[model samples]
Target chain A: MHVSFQVQAGDFSNAGKVSSTVKGILKQLNLGPAHIKRIIVALYEAEVNVVAHSYGGTITCEVEPESVDIMVCDTGPGIPDLDLAMTEGWSTATPEVREMGFGAGMGLANIRKNTDRLAIDTGEDKPTRIHMCFDLADGATHA
Target chain B: MTLRDVVQIVDGTVLCGDDNLGREVHLGFASDLMSDVLTLLADDILLITGLSNNQAIRTAEMSDILQILFVRNKRPTKTMLDLAKEHGITIITTPYSMFRSSGLLFSKGLQPVY
Candidate 1:
């Protein structure tokens, strides 16, 4: 089964809703605990990015017996420097978002650490798309 | 350590899912950064933090944490409690500072999540 959603910026009230829904679906699909955890973590980081940066965006998840693939896309200020953006402890999130317990510059790194395969494509203020896959066996992806 | 032990150490008031106090937690993460908690391997974890936002509950719920400890007597509002209830997570309030509450847990053999 595949799941997708639109994530909106500054929509704190419903920020995590997409991730929660994906969690329920993954649980119902009988995905293993480790795999499910990876999916949820990646989903959350993507969702948080949309809320904190983009005006709003879409999240799509493709689930197979072997793996789960997720894509989070948004029309926000695209990463000026993808390398820096991918670094741990780097963040461009505003103070308000930080106060809400997010924007620690850990979103992409956390997603990479949790998922098995990650690919990113972005252009400033254009659409930024992050593609991540978590293997069912290990729930880890490098680079 | 278990949620019950954390509760006992902090002298915290149970806000929800008190029945789950018996659940065991393998590790604890103390942080106000939801993203930091997200970096943890989401298995049998406990969250201790001073953050009172709804995001804290949401993050814990997604991570399937066994318990939440809001230190410094920072009680969660009715909305936050409801969120915790919906996620089947136990929330406890301790008058102790965040450092003290987590310190007590560490002394009691609760491992920290890296």
Candidate 2:
């Protein structure tokens, strides 16, 4: 099955809607609880990143019998330093974002922790694309 | 501990999910940062936080947390309560601070998720 959702910039109120919908779908598929949790957590962090950082984005999810693939693409002032952005405590969120209990800089780390395979396409003044894959079969990849 | 015991220990009022007060939580995680909360991988966690907002409820929903203990008397908005209800997450509010609430729960045998 395949599905896509639009994410609005600074739309904290509706940030998790995509993840929630995907979670419901996964539940109906009878995926393992652990797999569902990890997938949802990663998808949520990715969704929030677009809402909190980029101008806006689209999240697309493709589910197969053996794995799930999610791609998040956002119009952006993309990350100039991928390594720094990946650091656990580094963030560029504004004060307002901080007030909302986000911007602790764990977003990408959480995504990395939960996904089996990940890729990113980003740069200054360009859109950022995050691609994440999770194995649905043996669940051996989870740490 | 069951959520009922947690409510008694913290002198909390159930903001939502009163019917779920009997639900048991095995671990407690206290944080105001939603990102930190997202990093947690455990199940049956009672998210204790002062950040009472839609994002906190959303975080709990994504994490599969069934209960949230809002400290420092931080009452959740209607939107937050509604979101929690839709997800079947129990919400409780306490007058104590985060430190005090966690300490109280810990003293009463609520294990930490570390």
Candidate 3:
């Protein structure tokens, strides 16, 4: 199965909608609870990153019987340094964003922790693309 | 601990999910950073935060946290409360600071989310 969602920039109110939807779908698929939680955590962090940093974005999920592939592409000021942006305490979020309880710079770290594999492609003037994969079989082992 | 016990310990007022007070929570995490909250692996945890925004509710929903305790007398906005209600998350507020709230709950036998 496949699902797509649009994420709006600075749309904190609707930030987790996509993750929530995907989580419900995963539950319906009878994915293990631990696997569902990991996938949702990664997806939610990615979705929030788009809302927090990008102008907007699109999230595509391709769910196979054994794995889930997720891609998030955003039109915004792309990251200048992937390594630096991946750091846990480095963030460029506005003060207002921090006030809302985000912008701690752990979004990417959390995504990395939850996903089996992650890839990132970005440029200063181009859009940011993040692809993540979660192995259902591997996740089931942790359950 | 039961959410009802938490409310009594923190002297909190239930802003939403009154029916959920009977629910049990195994751990407590206190943070204003949504990212920090996301890193928590445990479920059925109680989040104590000073932030009273929709993102806090959204983070709790995403992290599978069962209840939220807003400290320092912070109250969530109408929109935030609505979102919490929609997610079936219990929201409680206490006049205590985040430290005091967490300390109270800890003293009352709430475990850490580590």
TM-score each candidate: 0.92, 0.96, 0.94
> What C-alpha RMSD separates each model from the true structure?
3.2, 2.5, 2.2
In DockQ, how does model 1 score against the reference complex? 0.84
Tens digits of per-residue lDDT, candidate 1, A48-122, equal: 888988888899988877678888888867888899999988888899899889988889888888877889998
Please count the clashing residue pairs in each candidate, in the order shown.
Answer: 4, 0, 0
Candidate 1 lDDT, B1-114, residue by residue in tens = 667778888888888897887788878789998987887765777789999988998899788785888989887888888888888889889999989988889999888876
Query: Could you give the CAPRI-style class of model 2?
Result: high
Candidate 3 deviation (Cα RMSD): 2.2
Task: Please give the distance, in angstroms, between residue A132's alpha carbon in candidate 2 and its true position after superposition.
Answer: 0.4
**Alpha-carbon local distance difference test for all models:** 0.84, 0.90, 0.88
Off by over 4 Å in 1: A137-143
Two-chain complex of model 3, DockQ on C-alpha atoms against the true structure: 0.83
Candidate that scores best on DockQ? 2
lDDT of 3 by residue, B12-42 (tens): 9999999988898888998998889888888
Model 2 chain B worst lDDT run, 10 consecutive residues: B35-44
Candidate 3, residue A118: lDDT: 97
Tens digit of per-residue lDDT, candidate 2, span B1-114? 899999999999999999998888889999989988888888789999998778899889888899999998898998899899999999999999999999999999999988
The CAPRI classification for model 1 reads as high
Worst 10-residue lDDT window for candidate 3 chain A reads A134-143
Candidate 3 residues A51-85, lDDT tens each?
88899989999988889999999996899998998
